[model samples]
Target chain A: MSYNKRNDGRAFDELRPMDAKVGIIKNALGSAMFRIGKTVALAAVYGPSELFPKFLQKKEEGLLRCTYNMMAFSGSGTRVKPGPSRRSREIELVTRNALESVLDLSECPRAVINVNIELIQTDAGTRCAGICAASMALADAGFKMKDLVAAVSAGLVGDKIVLDLDYSEESFEEGAVDIPMAFMPRTGKIALLQLDGEITKEQLREAIKLAKKGCKQICEVQRQALKEKYKTEE
Target chain B: MGILIEDKQIVVPGEEVAEGMDFLPAPGTFRDGDKIVACQLGLVNISGRLIKVIPLEGAYMPKRGDVVIGKINDLTYSNWFVDIGYAYEAALSMKEATTEFIERGAELTDYYTYDDVIVAKITNVTKSKSIDLSMIGPGLRKLQGGRLLEISAQKVPRVVGKQGSMISMIKEITNCQIIVGQNGRVWISGTEIWQERLASEAVLLIARKAHTHGLTDRVKAFLESGSKK
Candidate 1:
C-alpha cells in the first residue's frame, strides 16, 4: 500500500511548526525552550566548572555531559518513568556526542559542561527537539562552538518520505521508518544519524536530503532565539 | 571582501564575521577557510584590520593580579582554601595571608575561619588550574559588615567604568564603600542600610544595561534620582 498523504496534512517536505526561545531559566548559565508540534524540550547549560571524580577529568579538553529526561506525564501514549531509564541513557549519550562536535573546550581543561534536557511534552520527535534546544542553550551560555547543531526526523510512513514525523505518523498502521538526524548547517556535517527501521538505499538518501533541508530551517530558528535574548531596546 | 557584521552588532557561533583575508581573526573568532567566523555569542568588535568578538557572558577564568572576593571554605595548618568563584579553590598560605608574619601551626580560623568573606589578589594560576591568592595587598582584607551582591563577571569592567569614574561616582553619591571583585562578587558597606541597598541596586542596574549605550549618564541620573527617592 502507498501512503499519499501525511496524517497531519503537512506536505512531504514540510516540518511541524516550531517555536523556540532562549534565556528561559535565569539561574542556569544558559537556557532555552524548543517546541516542535506537540513535543516541548527545555534545555539548561551549567558549568565548564569543576569536574568531579577526578578520573573522568580530561587534561586536554573539557567534557560535555548531557542528560535527557521525560516528565511522568509527557508521553502521548502512557506515563513516562520519573527517573533515568535505559532509553534515556542512550539518548543522553547520543545527545552529548551530537553537541560535542561543535564545542571548543580546550580552554576549560579539567572542567565539564553539562547540558540538561527535559522533555515537558513528547509527540515523537523528543530527541530532535532536545538537541535543538540544547544547541541554543550552549550558544546562549557563550560557549565557543564551531557551529550550531539542528536536528529533525525524516523517514517513510508506509512508502512516502516525510519530514518531521508526528505521533500519528510514527504509529501508522503501515510500516514506518523513523530516521532522526542532526546536522551542522554551515559545514553540512552530520552530527547525528539514527534509523529505526529499514528502507531502500535510494529512499534513505532522499530522506536524508529532506532532513538536511529541515535542519537548515531549524538552524535559522535557533539563531533567532539566541539573538532575541540580547536584543537591545529601541 | 568585507566585514559582514557591523561593529557592536551581536553574532553567534559559526556566523561569518568577515568574508575576506583582509580581516585578521582575533580571540573569540577563528579563520574558517577564507572566512572569519565567530566562535562565541558576542558583540562583533572591529578595529582597523582586526576582527574580534567580545563575549557577553561566561564563567570567570581566574587571571593573575586580579583582585577578587572569596569566602573561606576550608583551612589547613598553613593554608586556607578560598572559593573565588572559579572551578578550582584558591590557596592562601599563611605567608601571603597578611602583612604580619603568621607563625607555623598557628590557629588558622582565628585569622580566617570558614565562610569568612575576604578580598584578596590572585598571585598565580598554574596550568593545572590551581590558583594562589594573596591577602597582603592594599584593599585586601576580611569584609566586616556589608551586603554582598553577585553580578556577571563579564560586566565587572563596565561597573568599574573607564579609570574608576563610574564606581567613584557611585561611592560619592551613595556614601558607601564599594569593592567589586573581578570574579563578579561585590561588597558594599554604608553607614545607613538604605545607602547600601541603593548602591547595590545601581550596580545591578549597570550590569543589566552594560551592553546599552549612554550607560554612564543613565547611571548618574539613576543614582541622583535614587538618592532623592
Candidate 2:
C-alpha cells in the first residue's frame, strides 16, 4: 500500500490533538468537553440523585444510564436529525458500559446517575470521544471511581495501523477496519471493544496494543482536566 | 504487593496503588488480581497492613454504626422515613425509635413531626440498600431549637478530631451546645444567635480547610478573632 502518510500528516501510530475541560456545565453535578482532532463531545452527569420508577431499582448498587446524541449541525452538510437513531442507541449502551466499569456505583445505592454525551462535532472517533468525556464528567461529579478510563480508535489502513483516524481515513479505501477500544488505566482492563471492519488475527493483536497505549495518553489528558477542576488551595 | 505510591500521595482515578499480595486494599481502593488500585482522587493513607484512600471530595454515604442527623420525611405504619441527604431514605422503626410501646392507632406525628431533625444511629444497612435507624442509644433524640449546619461528611473526622478534642474545643470556645452528626450535620445552640453563627463559621473554617495541619490552633484563633469583633 503506497501512502503519503496520514491526511493530518501524523504517523501510522500517532494520535490527533487532544484537549479536555471539566465542569463546563455549571448546573451539572459533573460536566466535561473533550476534543480529539475535529471530533468534539460534551458530556454531563446528573443525579446520583434518585432512581425513578421504583420497581427497577437495584438493591445493591446505583443505576447508571447514558444518553449518546449527535447534534444536527455536527456533521458536514445535510443536517442529521437530532434524535436517537439506532446508531446513537448502540453507542449509548456501550458508553454506559465503558463508564460503569470504572465508577464505584455501589457506593450510592438506590440512586441513579445519568450520564449524557452530545457529539457537537464529528470527525471519525465520536464514540471514543464520547466515552472519554462522560467518564471525566462522572469523576468531576465527586463520584469515587475505581480509576479514570479513556478510549481511542485505531484502524487498519491497507496494511498500515493508524491511530485516531479522521473521517477521511475512516471511510477511505477498501478493507480499512475501525477498532475502537475503551480501557481502564488503573487495572489495565478493556471495558468496551468494537470492530467496525474486518481484519486478520495478527492485525487485531497489534491494533489492541497500539490502541491501549494511545488510551493511556488520552487518560493523562483526562487526569489533567480533573486535577485542574478539583484543585484546592493547599 | 509493594505499594506503588507513597503515603499521603495524591492519586487520581485509575492510578495503581500497590502491586503484590504484600499490601491490602482498604476503603477507597479496590483490588485487581494482586494489584491494589486507587479508584478516587485523594490522599493515600497506608495504615498498618492496609492501604486507605481518603477521598478529598466526600459526598456523604451512610455506613453502619454511623451517628447521623436525619429529618422525618414521612411516617409509615411502623416506621418513620428519614431523609439523610442522599437518595436512599432510611427507615426508623417505631420499635427501635423508642423503647416505649403505645397502643395501636396512635398518631405518628405526635412523636416526631414532619421535618423534625433527629440525631440517631444507623443500626443496620441491609443488602437491598434499606437503612435501619435507632434512636434508643445514648445522646440520641429529637433535636429542637438549634441552628443546623452542614459540612462534607469526609470532613467530619477532622472536625471531631482525636478523642473529641476538636469538637470540644469549639464548644468550649464558642460556649455553645454542639452536636455533630456523622452525616456532616451540626446542631449548634448558643444563648445568642450571633454566638451560634460565630460557632458555625468556626466549624465552616475547619470544613473548608480541613486538609491543613494544626487546624485546632487555627480554629481557636479564628473563634477568638470573631468573638472580639
Total backbone collisions for each predicted model: 0, 8
User: Which runs of model 1 end up more than 4 angstroms from their true locations?
Assistant: A232-234
On the 0 to 100 scale, the lDDT of residue A66 in model 2 is 94
Clashing pairs in 2: A146-B39, A147-B13, A147-B14, A148-B13, B1-B20, B1-B21, B1-B22, B1-B23
Give the per-residue lDDT of model 1 (tens digit) for B1-229: 8989999998999899999889999999999899999999988999999999988888888899999999999988779999998777899988899887667666778899999999999999887778999998788999999999999888899999999999999999999999999999999999999899999999999988877889989999999998997
Indicate the docking level reached by candidate 1.
medium
Residue-level lDDT of model 2, residues B102-169, one tens digit each, is 67999888898899999999999876667899999899999989899988777889889899999998
Q: Where does model 2 exceed 4 Å of error?
A: A1-9, A21-33, A46-49, A71-80, A107-110, A119-124, A140-146, A156-160, A167-177, A198-206, A228-232, B99-103
Best model number under DockQ: 1
| Chain A TM-scores, candidates in order | 0.97, 0.94
DockQ of 1: 0.71
